[model samples]
Target: MTVPMERHIARTRIRDSRLGQHNVRVNPGEYFVTGDSSVMIITVLGSCIAACIRNPLNGFGGMNHFMLPQSDEGEWNGVSSHMRYGNHAMENLINEVMKSGCRRSEMEIKLFGGANMYVGTSEIGAKNARFVTDYLREEGLKAIASDLGGHHGRRIHYWPATGKVKRLLLTGGEDSRVATAETTYRSRLAAAPVEGDIELFG
Candidate 1:
């Protein structure tokens, strides 16, 4: 039997007040924006990348979780064209922060994820880490710090208002949950490459 969408979502949330009562959890292929100093933004990642960005002066910030870099030739089949790609994701997050009364020059950027979890295939995680690093340099933006390219996953907690981050690298059993989420995400991309609207939870 399938569960109701609302119930499923409620059960999926972290439920820890440590992130604050108004915190938002960003899932793969989606982003969340806010200017509220009291709220937090969080996500878990494996191979995928989540960029935590904020404008210090205005206290506007957001986080985006993207699975891959853009293809130079063509668009992705079913995924939201811009949201799931690194370049577009980065641009969108910045745009959202700016729209909330922040400027690009005052932004504090920190990136997480891109672990080399796959044993045999190409190190997509490494590629992803390298891609973001290069992209920022090319755009003349400096990332304050990054936790990228390792054999482990990450649980990221970002306080947008203060531009503070608590990046916890996962090990042992923590790997199972992140691995499952990433596997399901890739399977969705493979099974149905079509455009659809994504609802924002925050």
Candidate 2:
């Protein structure tokens, strides 16, 4: 069974004194959706992708952070495995926003956070960028803006209600943190068990 979206929504909430708004930090394998203008969603990415989707008509939107392009077939037994892949991540975020009284036809899309953190390793960042690009095309959706496929990481702040985003490219130590976090996350997923039934795509 694929875990409910509630389990995947980011919970690390904080009050941004500078911005005077509530900010939620989204990690890999997580997403958060809301219609509230006061809430901002943020994430750091290294060889991962975060999709920002919102409905301009209703001011309802959400974001998803995922590390992989697609889950392996029959690898759907673990809850974390689901949202960690682009296919499931995109679908869930879009569905949640639509469920908040927004229609798919009214959605605006923005893409961010695919960096080639691993120098000589397999180009997972490129793979992720390619996957999302293909996924959006297959679903007949278009991104109005994007910053993807570089040699550095990025920090993203997004207001789902307004479809506004601020991106800060990570430098030196900041970039290292993102790469380290994703490495640990990937390790954990490798050790995690298969337990859900969500369909996988490539």
State the displacement of the C-alpha of residue 28, model 1, in Å, after optimal TM-score superposition: 0.5
lDDT of 2: 0.77
Worst 10 residues of 1 by lDDT: 2-11
Candidate 2 vs. truth: CA RMSD?
A: 5.4
Residues 18-104, candidate 1, lDDT per residue (tens digit)?
745465788887787766666677888999988888767766777888776333334555533432366666776766666555556
The number of the candidate with the highest TM-score is 2
Question: Model 1: how far is 118 from its true place, Å?
Answer: 1.1
Q: List, residue by residue over 79-182, the lDDT tens digit for candidate 2.
A: 33433456667877887766655666667999997788886867878888887898889777899999999999989999876788999998999988888889
Model 2 segments beyond 4 Å from truth? 1-8, 69-84, 193-202
In the order shown, the candidates' Cα RMSDs to the true structure are 7.7, 5.4
How accurate locally is residue 34 in candidate 2, as Cα lDDT from 0 to 100?
Answer: 74
